[model samples]
Target: MVFTREKTLDRAELEAYWKEAPATLEGHPIKVLSGYGPHEVWEGESTEGVVIAEFPSMEAARAWYHSPAYQKAREHRVKGAVYRGILVEGTTPQD
Candidate 1:
């Protein structure tokens, strides 16, 4: 969930979101090894930031998204920026 820096979210809060993200899955299925954010939106109607996550499986990913723990964090997320996510299944190269 990318929390655009609206009038509510400040730099410190965004930083806190980064710090607390690890606790979302408690270092189990979720792994966000590296992330970069808060870049200038030199486009049409872009958010203030972006966050990416990798999960062990699609089910795991969905679970984490709906989990109550993450839901609480989601509150902070909603106020922070534009929330967007997708559960996509990977595929091998076509033969």
Candidate 2:
């Protein structure tokens, strides 16, 4: 999943979401590829920050996103900042 921050964040809500979200990853094989940090946009509209995460499969990703724990955390994130999130399946390279 790729999430692009769209506006200033509510620090309190963001903090809360972060705190709760990590705990929810206990059973999922989710790996964070890129986190919110300094980024240079090559083209198109600019965004404040971006976060990229990878899951083993689409089913796993959906399970994580819709899980109760994550859903609870997502509420705080939604309140904190607007984001454009995209979930795309990646192709595996042939060995």
Candidate 3:
């Protein structure tokens, strides 16, 4: 998830998004590789926050993303900030 806050439209809403998203993710086999923290833009423009979550498989990742609980939390995010998000499968090393 990559978030670029044009403006905090609603602090309360954003807070709710933050609070509810993780709770919804509980029990999922996901590993948070990176999340809200300091980062350097080596090239192009960067967003305010970048989050990378690793799952056992693409199906699992999609399941988490589209889950009803997460979709509810996502409502707050949509109302609160400008962002871009995508899911990409990682490449494995060649033998």
Candidate 4:
């Protein structure tokens, strides 16, 4: 699932958040594959930060979000901005 938070955060603080993210998600059930933000595109589509993660399972993904490591990461994100988040099920092929 991808999460987005609008332009509530300043550049410096957002950068700090980005810096702390990768290591924190390591060995977790949910893997953050990629994250990105618009580089001041000057478009009215809303400037926001985006995150994409891969989860082992929906339950595992939720668990990771509530875990202590993510909690720590959340602190910085909250300070930086306000966000809207969601989770979507991943596709799998049966054997």
RMSD of each: 4.0, 2.5, 2.4, 4.6
Q: Candidate 2: which stretches are off by over 4 Å? A: 92-95
lDDT of 4 by residue, 1-95 (tens): 67877767666766677788767667776666767734454666774667778887888778778878777877888888877788889877799
TM-score of each: 0.63, 0.89, 0.84, 0.70
Compared with the true structure, what per-residue lDDT tens digits does model 1 show for residues 1-95?
22234344555554565566658777457766334554667876765445566677888887888877777777666665545565666667896
lDDT of 4: 0.74
Tell me the tens digit of each residue's lDDT in model 2 across 1-95.
89998885798998888899899998999999999979999998889899999998988999999999999999999999888989999986798
Candidate 2 global Cα RMSD:
2.5
Number of backbone-clashing residue pairs for each candidate, in the order shown: 2, 0, 0, 0
After best superposition, candidate 3 residue 28: deviation in angstroms?
Answer: 1.4
Cα lDDT listed for each candidate? 0.61, 0.91, 0.79, 0.74
By lDDT, the better pick of 2 and 3 is 2
What are the per-residue Cα lDDT tens digits for candidate 3 across 1-95? Answer: 33345346778888989989989888788988888767776777666776777888889888888999999999999898876777888888899
- Report the CA-based lDDT of candidate 2 relative to the real structure: 0.91
Indicate the worst ten consecutive residues by lDDT in candidate 3. 1-10
The TM-score between candidate 4 and the true structure equals 0.70
Candidate 2's TM-score reads: 0.89
Best by lDDT: 2
* Superposed Cα deviation of residue 20, candidate 2 (Å): 1.1
Q: What is the Cα-based lDDT of residue 18 in candidate 2?
A: 83
